[model samples]
Target: MSVPKPIEFRGSALDDLRAFPLAARREAGHQIDRVQHGQEPDDWKPMATVGQGVKEIRIRDAAGAFRVIYVAKFADAVYVLHCFKKKTEKTSKADLDLAAKRYRDLVKELAQ
Candidate 1:
């Protein structure tokens, strides 16, 4: 079987991420860069699952842990979907549902 596709985050999400402060952006940048290099990068914490086609990249700050869902669209590009802070040990089913829904929406939009 062929390798699975990586979803990409374009448009607003890209703009938002690009607008993050240098430090925060750098953190994401470093992690994402590893992905570009064919690594499944993880930080100090384990990742939370948002859905089948969606996986959340976990990050932490003074506020605690949060997640960002990025879609691998190509060998070198990943499109981040949504970013939100986590309050529980496990990823909420609601978050996964939202990610799954958004993933479908993104796929449908990108196909055109």
Candidate 2:
């Protein structure tokens, strides 16, 4: 197999991920590792609202539901745009907007 691509956390994603409960954080890491290796996460869904090719990794644990929004279409690395604990069934507009902003920032940064 080819070498795995590294993950680049955008905005406050890393810090946000660190805030997840231990179990949830570990699961998130495992799922992201799968994405790095060009494999699908255990659970995921397209996040077209964030951008083209963007997706969200879903992780549920005894504590709560968590999400990691990312884009892996680029060759160099998988970009993690957002990480958050989901308090309700629906993803909040603020969370969606934050991820989209981060995605746009990443694209702009890479273009420079």
Candidate 3:
């Protein structure tokens, strides 16, 4: 079996996570660790392609629903593109745009 890639969070994604309540943040961290270790949590779902490969980790707790967008296509790492509290049934265009932009930036950075 292949080894799992390390997970790296973008500055903006980290900032978003920092704003989460303690419980949600802790759960998200655990889920991310699972992904890093090659286990795809049952709650995770693939996002429609915008540019680079992206998937969403869905977390719902007493604090409410939270979403984490990440790309795992890189050879050496999984890049967390965005994290935010999901306030509606549908994801906002602004959030999608931000995550897509971050994914694109990470792809360019990896190529260099």
Candidate 4:
């Protein structure tokens, strides 16, 4: 696939990937594949406003209920923002923070 014109990011999205091991990063590409194809889990939700025209997607991975946030419908590709292994119950506030941070960074980089 081709890279999108622009990608969105926030702290959470960055942290998710940052926290992952090298293997997880490789595996994340597969998950992104499913996301672009509308195969994300049923629990997924949008993270709302990010950049001037960017949108964030949050989803619960069916395999491990991990919380994943990323930018979708990004031109020709979906950029995986972040992925976090769940913590038993709902996702914690930290997750959101990271997502927000990623968003800011992306917006700044793109001057959005």
**Top TM-score prediction, candidate number:** 2
lDDT of each: 0.60, 0.96, 0.85, 0.54
Full-model lDDT, candidate 1: 0.60
- Give the alpha carbon lDDT tens digit for every residue of 29-52 in model 2: 999999999999999999999999
Would you list the clashing residue pairs of candidate 1?
6-72, 6-73, 7-71, 7-72, 7-73, 8-79, 9-79
Screening candidate 2 with a backbone cut-off below 3 angstroms (N, C-alpha, C), the clashing residue pairs are none
Better of 2 and 4 by lDDT: 2
Residue 85 displacement in candidate 1 (angstroms): 1.1
Best by lDDT: 2
lDDT of 1 by residue, 1-112 (tens): 3443354664455665665555566677777666655566586332335433445566776646656677664344565666555779977877666666666776676678
Among all windows of 10 consecutive residues in model 1, the one with the lowest summed lDDT is: 44-53
The per-candidate count of clashes, in order, stands at: 7, 0, 0, 10
Ranking by lDDT: 2, 3, 1, 4
The C-alpha local distance difference test score for the whole of candidate 3 amounts to: 0.85
Candidate 3 C-alpha lDDT tens digits along 1-112? 5676887888688989989999989988998888787778669888876464678999898989999998776679888889999999999999988888887788788789
Model 4 segments beyond 4 Å from truth? 1-28, 36-43, 49-63
After superposition, candidate 2 runs with Cα above 4 Å error = none
User: Per-residue lDDT for 1-112 in model 4, tens only?
Assistant: 5332343334446565667556555466555566666566334565664333333334334445455577664454455555687666756777656666765765466564
List TM-score per model, in order: 0.60, 0.97, 0.89, 0.54
C-alpha RMSD for every candidate: 5.3, 0.7, 1.8, 5.1
Off by over 4 Å in 1: 1-25, 44-53, 73-76
